[model samples]
Target: MLEEEYQPRRQLPVHLRPPVQPEPVFEFTIRDATLADMPYVREIYNHYVANTVVTFDEDAMTLKEWRTKFSWVSKLNMPFLVAVSPTSTVLGFAYVSPWKQKAAYRRTVEDSIYLGPAATGKGLGKALMKELLARSKAAGIKEVLAVIVDKGAEGSIRLHESFGFVEVGRLGKVGFKFNRWLGTVLLQKHLK
Candidate 1:
């Protein structure tokens, strides 16, 4: 018998090992937000507000302030949607607001989408946006704009681009957060 050549099994680095698959924790349902959903929605937004320059706000919104915002969006007949779990846990929320306080800009809206840190990277954002944009079209919206932070938001930029948004403008070093300068990328999408 011929002697077999000695070969050793290759060992992979610990970091290069296959990732642990996360369990399916919840099923999300996208629907118009109710007054009851405001608190959870505020919680999600406050996460970003407190930790990031995403909203340029350093303070959290009080319940009353959240109510005022809900009322304002309702007054405009804008869609304020939430993604919820089967047990009624809010995973994310999205809405549209006036891009500018002028009659000429009434048909154009600025969209904001926020997801709980745990709820991201699982397609919840996309689902909420699909419902949001559909509602916008039904509400006669002509354009939708997204103002995204460009520092560490590549996923956000990619998501918007996947939905046909085009970068129309960029403001460099326009925001300061965590002792570092940040930039804003403005993207727009037109609906027919």
Candidate 2:
């Protein structure tokens, strides 16, 4: 009898395999956000809110609501930064918000970062976070917290961890989205 060659099968189908995403071709300039950047900023965030479980919000926020939120951050004098391309396109944004409304939480801020669909997989997110953290430290912030979705957020967790953030806690099944229960992972970086 003739021996036959063995063949291996792929667990993931070809169409289901992850796509090869190229690194950004353009360099990014990180800077403090301005009122003019709100539209682009909102656009990036709405993309995540609409398409992914990355954000717990199931519905996309209106521009008016986003502007209000931005105004609030500005009023608090927190750092709201945007990564712009050479052409002035907003590639991503990172901001620090009060962790809670109480005065006791004033020194602690929660970080929220959103990258344009095309801007991800590049170093923009990390660069933005570094700038935001530096600014927060300079502004006398004591701690920065990141509450990230457990699923589809490994990159975010890794980015935070790379910047000295450690996982402080995890909340299982705390969110329901896309017909499934999702968890949250809380990470903290002490700046003081």
Candidate 3:
């Protein structure tokens, strides 16, 4: 009689084994931001400023500048949201601000989304952006603009497109960063 072929069972190394206890899914809460959230907000923003082309600013913002920004947004009664975990750790933030300083631009606001390094790819940015847009609509914002860097930001471009923002313009070589010139893509979603 032919003996059945024996198959060896593969064993995973201890470190490669799946965790016996699964980590609990992180819980997130989205809410209107207050003065107390300024530090966390600034930290998240500065993370992008220091590490990415999400903004063209070469220098990180000081706490005083962040505070001034918060004050300005508050005075405008614009929408600002913070995503927090159950323990109140800020994961990300989104807000709407005047697109331009001119009075004619009052109804047009630029939207900004910033996430902590660890908070990306978990849908937190999308959630925050949705809430921000809802609040902007309720506040009578006519146009929502997204000014995005054109270099390797396909994810951001896709996200805005998914939210009904259409590419309205592209400015070439408008930004200098990372030892090279970069372009800017402007997307707009009409709210009114």
RMSD for each of the candidates: 6.4, 7.1, 5.2
Specify the highest-TM-score model's number. Answer: 3
| lDDT by residue for model 1 (44-155), tens | 9999988877776778888788889889999999999999889889999999999999999999999999999999989998898888999999999999999998877788
How many angstroms is residue 72 displaced in model 3 relative to the true structure, after the best TM-score fit?
Answer: 0.5
lDDT at 60, model 1: 88
Please tell me which model should have the higher TM-score, number 1 or number 3. 3
* Tens digits of per-residue lDDT for model 3, 1-192: 345666667899999998799766967999988888989988888877788887998898888887798889989989988999999998888899999999999989999988888888888878888889899999989999999999968888999999999999999999999898999999999986
Local lDDT at 147 for model 2: 97
**Model 2: residue 114 alpha-carbon error in angstroms:** 0.9
> Which TM-score value belongs to model 3?
0.89
For model 1 the local lDDT of residue 164 reads 97
lDDT of each: 0.90, 0.91, 0.89
> Which is the better candidate, 2 or 3, if ranked by TM-score?
3
- Candidate 2, residue 152: the lDDT equals 93
Q: Candidate 1: worst 10 consecutive residues by lDDT?
A: 1-10
